[model samples]
Target chain A: MSSHQAVREGAKQVVRLLEKFPEEKFKYLVSFKATQLERFSRIAGIPLPKKLATEVPGENKTSINEIKDIVNRTSGPLGLQKDMLRKMQAAIPHDQFTESAMKDQITALSNLVNNKYKNYYDVGDKLYKPAGNPEYYQRIIDDIQGKKKENILAGLRTVFMGR
Target chain B: MLKCTARKSSLNTVTKLYGINAAKTYNYNPVSLYSTTNKNLQADQKKQTELEFDTHGSPIVRGQKSTIPEYKLPKWKEALGEYVIKTFGLDMDKIRAGPVAGSYYYSICKEQGLQYENEPLSDSAKFFYEDLKLPKTFSQWFQITALHEWMLFVRMRAMPFKYGRNYQQKLVDKTFSDIEMRLFDEMNIHSGRIVDQYSKDFNSQLKGAVFAYDVGFYTDDTTLATAVWRNLFGGRKNIDYTHLDAVVKYIRSQLYVMSRMSDREFALGKFKFVPTKEKINKLSAQEEEEMKQKIIKKYEELDKSGLLLPSDKSNLSYDN
Candidate 1:
């Protein structure tokens, strides 16, 4: 229920209580409740939201698939902590299903999924160098240099094929 | 209506009428139309020798040497003994095509007395295809085949002149014959038309091999990587460089390993490709030497069995 609707209902209950009890003793409790609700309405700098929860959009299962798809495309660049939903799904306990725990799991999965993408954003669209064998590279250099001076030069002793 | 009043004058009549002014000068300029190709040197013989060498063998000089090796080959009778040729030992056109083409007919015949071909010679190498995990895809499969062919080419190049040519010819001949067979049997193509296709493929492959050799043999790993990525990997521009690096390493390791094999081993087709996983570049010198020693020992055992031919190990001075 919305905050306004709940407040209206609570006020009706207080009115009913006042009518039944006919006592000043419970007035302070009612006033204290009003003060608490007022305090909650204003937080640090921003006003606290009393917006009612609409149907929490979609199911986590389909969202999980979408999350996986994003992870596959972006996670290649991230190069770590992959198979997010698969791992999370595997880790979820079958014995118990708690809303808060499920929500926490979702938060953790989202964090894992989003972090790589954010890291990708930080990386920008720059080209990445692949892993290579340094020794092999060196050997290739050595081979070519040797060939250049000896084989190529020797072949070109009589004829000059421009290097 | 137009009438033909103008008489057609012959050259003499025109010249007679116009006198010396109308006469065309017949003075021949001293410049020769054809330039002397060889000039003073007897380069025809040298060219012939080089052609002969190229015809019968892979024209690979030692890594250190630049001089062209002379055209030396096995006796025509010995090399072509089994083939049913009646007249000439070797044809001029065949010789001109180079050793690879000239040896094409003889190379197809299975080596009769060899351990693997005949009754077991006891020293035949047991290289299983499964160990290498050769790629199953057509492009990759061909790449692996190309790798094997290229390896043989390297060995052929490194080989002492006489045997190198023979081996090169045999390998190429086998390749062509195999292609011919594939076309005829598998592809349902007629035998008569196989050679046209074979020649096309053979020339194309040789061209590709030359590039791969230059890139893989002499250049840096990145170049080798690029070459492999182009030829072996189908030039996929989006391919990961790390994968290219891996391919470069694979090529480097193969070249190194192939360089170590004795000509006998290569001739026998006994060299086992280093598995893709075993990075040869990672091995220590001592470890590599130890491995070489083990290979040497295996060959020694084969040598004892009298299977190895004694290739000339001495250097011969040839005037360039």
Candidate 2:
């Protein structure tokens, strides 16, 4: 591959690594990613892709899972565990993943995972809230529809009328 | 109606004169009859006269001139001394020195001066001489006069203040130093150039302080008062330069806005350019000469066109 393509691939790898880490772990990972992107951009003579730097919903499954794990692990610490569970409950799509089913899966994961790995559930809870919520998804859909309508009107005026 | 008592002793004297009246009482004792006759004559005089007359004038009228004697005039010097004493209340003994005092003394002693010469001296002169208690020595008096002369000399001198005029000089100096830091950021002039220009303009304008002082002394004109303030703090070295920058910026911005509004308006519009007297003063000597030439040329053009007013071109020569 060319050096530019290599830098682009390297920036993508850093984004993947950040997605897998817990919230606190991901904070350090994001800082590292930023530095790496800066170096890559300097070598490639172009900015890093926005997808590699930003937290993208639905597509970033690894980050979603990490946040879920953090929420489940921190459930016993004061009322933080309950709050995280409630936030996660509101976050995950009920039709896709029912709360009862997710709780059963969490219990099963808690038995399997070490205590150090549990913090990822807390991070998972925060990251997935906006993605899974019906209201958040509805707003995004509305925005897309509005933009599409505007584009259609523009296209009709420009193309059909030759304006 | 007269009542008379006749004595019989008077009957014997006239008995022989008239035999028919021999029995009449014509014999008289001379003393009693004489007295009676006088009385009867006086009474008849009193009854006959209707008017009376006197031949002599009054004694008081005769004595009028001698009662009050003629006045002799007092000596002029003595009168003058009294006049001075009353008018100024000056102590003659203190001023009794050198020529003026000696002359006055001689006039007093010899009584040779004019009648009105004893009138009081002027307040200012007297104050200087006596009230101020100037030294009696001639050299000291000369020194005081010299000081007064020097003060007058300085009053007329057109010298610039080192900093500025009055309070404004200090303010200008401070503002200039402050603006020195921002000079490079704003205007692109070198710091040294800015400083030098500030100093030069500041000193040049400070010469107007004398004009202000003169205006104050004479006409009490407020325009010169503003000029004094401008000389001190509002000149090129001071806030005026900064204010000029602001004004230029505002004018430029206004032109931009007006241009946006209407191009025709922008084309026809005029912006005021009030050049300060100091700036006018600083025009090159050649420029001033050129200005004079232009004025003369304009006058000639007007004359040729028959537009020059009568007497307008008569005294048209340019001053420096």
- The second chain of candidate 2 has a TM-score of 0.17
Candidate 1 lDDT by residue in tens digits, A12-32: 332232222112121121222
In model 2, which regions exceed 4 Å deviation?
A1-163, B1-281, B304-307, B311-316
Q: How well is candidate 2 docked (DockQ)?
A: 0.00
lDDT for B11 in candidate 2 is: 31
The list of candidate 1 runs beyond 4 A from truth reads A1-163, B1-140, B190-195, B281-320
Q: What is the DockQ of each candidate?
A: 0.01, 0.00
| CA-only RMSD, every prediction | 31.2, 52.3
Alpha-carbon RMSD, candidate 2: 52.3
Worst 10 residues of 1 chain B by lDDT: B311-320
Give the top-scoring candidate (DockQ). 1
> What TM-score does the predicted chain A of each candidate obtain versus native chain A?
0.19, 0.19
Q: Say what the RMSD of model 1 is.
A: 31.2
In candidate 1, position B136 carries an lDDT of 28
Identify the leading candidate in terms of TM-score: 1
